[model samples]
Target chain A: MDSTIIIEKSVIIVAVFALTMLMAMYSTWAERKVAAWLQDRVGPNRAGPFGLFQPLADGLKLFSKEEFEPNTPNRFLFFVGPAIAMSTALMTSAVIPWGDRLHLFGRDILLQATDLNIGLLYFFGVVSVGVYGIMIGGWASNNKFSLIGAVRAASQMVSYEIAMGLSIIALLMMTGTLSLREISMQQAGMNWNIFYQPLSFIIFLICAFAEANRTPFDLAECETELIGGYHTEYSSMKMGFYLFAEYANMFISSTILAVLFFGGYNYPGMSWAVENWGVNIANVLGFGALFIKLCGFIFFFMWVRWTIPRFRYDQLMHLGWRILIPLAIVNIIITGTVILRADIAAYFGF
Target chain B: MSTVLIIFCVLAAITLATAFLTIFSRNPIHSAIYLVICFFSIAGHYLLLNAQFLAIVHVIVYSGAIMILFLFTIMLMNLNEEREVHRPRITRVGAIVSFCLICLVLIAIFINSKPIVGEYVTTGEDYQSIKVLGKILLNEYMVPFEFVSILLLVAMIGTVLLSKKEKLQK
Candidate 1:
């Protein structure tokens, strides 16, 4: 209701939007750079200042190019495809907490866009809807390769999501909260969840890779198999939207991985910084810390992508249903037993 | 208040309409997709309920995982535009008559029953959490919890038996 509060909320929203877009943009550049480095070649060095403007150049290219559509029956669904991709990609950021509240101009500015009690669930819901975009795009394209790509994507995301959800159960049991902010707050300083639930973290990390359709798990649209996968029929900005969504998902999932299992903006000396420097400066550092952590996860994504080969379809299924799901169930059981130890202890009288 | 009510009405319509379309669609694949729309509208309802967790889980389980399975079945079966089977006129008539009869009976029961409005009781708490759900499932609903494992085992065996290929005759 207050003017300052409104301004601060607007500022935070704008900042997060800017940050997500910027990250998605740079992800394109980073992918190119990493790909070039992996292949031992010079990646885009001709743009503004060591290819810093490469994303801009790429954006311009997408815009300037002729947008073509196949002579398909369903043009409406075709158009809807990329819109779904872009929107679903943007929507998942709603529940993520960017940082602790910033005390500015005598008002507390929450760093999150929205704090639904079930923020984690909301993230999963939005992220799961992301597959529909690809499925619709591929099916609507009326191309076999595109259809195959869509099927692969549908199967892959659905398969991996189970493991991802199960892996989170361990942390949820430990933290006893579904709110992303609460999860972050629980991880004060060195009490980051990775120390307690390393296996769950690893399972989640792998599942995140799978869910994002990154390497090894990226059997959905491997170039050798599906020829540009689901977006084979798309061109120009439409194609760009699909790729942009992928990179944006990568960034968001990495941010989540950092926040959930890693200490999420909580550095060792964060409280010290808050006490000595101030909330704004400390939170600035916290934001920086989160970014660094996020970058590490992104690099890890690219690193695994370049290092490993794609799994065979059967192997992918085996990993998802047989391996990851079972592992996740075990992790949940272990977490549950650990959490209810007092009750168990009382029952045993030991 | 009117705006919120209007929005709720539109969403509820979309939800129920899509759900009807899901079951009514002749093509199984179309049914799967309409089911997705139905899930989305339910998530909207969950947003209204302030049960963000259930909404997300609903999407994750039903829209994400379960629908994917349905889609996979459709794809694996290759249910193209041509393969749809049309039921006989009598079967169709029977279905329609039964559906209408059921609806009428439900409406009649509702109209005939005495109105029982009780005191408005607010939960006023975060009880629908994964943590709380787990506790309740393990403690109070342990019998049902254990029964699910047996049910899954029977289903698995049934599927294996049903899907077993016939022996070759030399």
Candidate 2:
């Protein structure tokens, strides 16, 4: 409630926003570069030194392109679609714990923008709302392909969300808290959730891929089938916003994955580092650790995208509903049993 | 008056306006969108009361899951185009009569329960936090909660049955 606290939070929010946008922008370049490397071709060396500034060039091109609007009845929704996508894509970072804390100007600064107790639910809520962008855009365009794409996206996201939520429940059973910061702290050092809840991690990873609409599961935007999918009618920076929102969603998903399963900002010898190197240095290294993990997940996303083929609509539905949901439920049952094993043993007089 | 009061008033205004817009919107998709906004404002009201868990769950359920389904149905039905359907005079009269009856019943209930409601009081207790809510749900409201789950399961089964492909008849 203090003015300084307000100022501090505002600074953190701005920094996180800039960081998210920067990461999303560069991810486009990285995706191209990685695709090229995998396919054995030169990606974008002409733009600026191995195409380091390719995303910037791409941004310029998108910005300068002629804005095109379809002859649709719902002009307002057409505009609202991309705006909603872009904003919701950027909103998920508000609850993520980017780092432990920083000692600066005689104050301990938390790296996250806000630490809501129900951070996990907030993430799910925002993600669920994200489907509207695609649905509204596709419908507003009044194109058949766009409408099909939007319907596919809505169904895919909704179906996958159940499994995703179930998988997270297993992890939640282990953590006993919904705050991402507490989850990060629980994974201090090499004590990651992945070690204990590997099944949960795998299910969560698959669901993350599905939720982000990334390949192997990107049926929503299956270009060959849906012809650019939901954003087929979009052009100029409006189209760019949809693409940027995808990358931003990918980046946020990777961050969530890293923070939940991987030891987020928690290196193996973090205690030793904190003891010897001091809090500031150790926390910086922790932040660096988190960065490395997220980047690794991002690269993994792109790697899978290039390597694997997309799923058929039926197959996607089957995997989500039949396989993933049942698996997640089993994982939850297993986790509950393990956690309460001692109680069960005591009750059984063993 | 206070910051909380101001926020409550703003949220209330949004909730009311969006609710009316949802009902009055010509396009089904627009109506769905307005309903989403209305749901969000109601969630905001929950947040205003410091019920963060309830607010987020409200968002995830109503705005996120249920409304997406609503929009999906609306979109699939292709209700974006304006269409006029003739209604019988009897149907309109019946609707109006039922609406008035419902309103009268609601008002009567509110008036009758006014004394029991008394005044708003803050207990300053950890009653609405997720941990406490979970405990209360599992312990105190355990039977009703289980019944709700059973009801949902039955509905899910019924939906599957209703949607399942019929067998070929000779």
Candidate 3:
């Protein structure tokens, strides 16, 4: 690659990295703020306006704390668990299309890091592997609570993953492509998919909540039952990594939700802006629009977390296997029938 | 081209080493983890071959889902290194013999086949794309595909039946 192209890619990679880190960091502050607001209390206002620097303070505190590892035989795997968790959290951003391509310096640069042909599958693959982090960490801790938490997390993720994949299949049938970039592009000009595939969107949203281990679905880390759950034995930055990875996952999940169901970066007068303003301006606006959508979804995640109580463990499993799975299957059949309505009509002599 | 070769060599080495570890590791959890590493290496090889669809699916199905279940089961059973019972001498001998025979057959097949000694040229546009794969699977392998789905449904029903606890009415 030419030096200019290399420089362009480096800049984009750095920007995406910074954006993901920034979003995750701020999500902690946002969560606490939202939670406090809902309970009618002042949330951290000691550091900067509205506790803007609260995340930084929290990071410093975590870093300063002592790191604790249990007396487990598998020392190596214990160390590797959080590293896996952190890396996998960052990895999913590679395939997400942040915005349409930006035209600048007489060359077009795709906003995504790399759009693999199998973007959707790559997403699920990375997400499914994320379970290893919790499993290894909890197992290596050699504590019953941690192990129980890990097992709960693993089974919960596995169950929700089926429903998640099934729900996506319905959306895939409607979109007819696996690449997230293609899906976003197809939903251009105010044709956001949520209008067409509302059931798929609802199922996907619920599954996403479970996959991210947010409240209501966070049976693995229920404080009263599991006593800190999977990260019970973790302290210092190790615990910070687990918490950070969850927020990072939530951010990515929100971005995925927006790109899949919402119009992504496609705005109502995008064509007008491209004609009047310019490609670069339009793309920048589109990026901002996408960011706004992501923030909205992130807010929704926190809102639900504060509003809803945690589900009991058995109830969680029942919802996953007995309810969501069957509902998702029906959604798929309905989506398929609707898509091929003309053929079905012809077969029935409509 | 040289970079791809280097990556492929690294992946192949890891795949072989991990497969051996998976077979020989005394700790069941460690063995499961080694098998996951082996699966990931194989997926890397799939990527090198430009089979993106197969690579991701291999990861999701094998390393992600199957191995997690394996690790979960090992943990649930509370299997530890100290409690692992040794195999009989005859079983060890038999295993060695079968392993050697498999290696010999693999070598024989390798020697008879044309060796790939040149630059890799990947041709065709979107040959492994989702649309192409879906079309081929539905049209060409439709029977087997449907059979697999039905088989999975039956397995699910069997699991529910087996695990269901009957009410002990007094």
Give lDDT per model, in order: 0.84, 0.91, 0.91
- For residues A92-173, write the lDDT of model 2, one tens digit per residue: 9999998888888999999899999989999999999999999999999989999999999999999999999999999998
lDDT of 3 by residue, B1-170 (tens): 69999999999999999999998988888999999999999999999988899999999999889999999999999886777788889998999999999999999878753332121124344656777677767986799899999999999898877667443332
Kindly report which residue stretches of model 1 are placed more than 4 angstroms away from their true locations once superposed: A1-7, A342-350, B16-31, B80-82, B88-157, B160-170
Chain B TM-score for all candidates, comma-separated: 0.64, 0.76, 0.71
Scored by lDDT, model 1 comes in at 0.84
Q: Measure candidate 1: CA RMSD.
A: 3.7
TM-score of 3: 0.91
Worst 10 residues of 1 chain B by lDDT: B114-123
Q: What is model 2's DockQ versus the real complex?
A: 0.81
Write model 1 residue lDDT over A30-72, tens digit each, in one string. Answer: 9889988999988999998879999999999998999999988
Q: Which has the greatest TM-score?
A: 2
Candidate 3 ranges beyond 4 A from true positions: A1-3, A344-350, B81-125, B146-161, B164-170
Which ranges of candidate 2 are over 4 A from the true structure?
A346-350, B80-123, B165-170
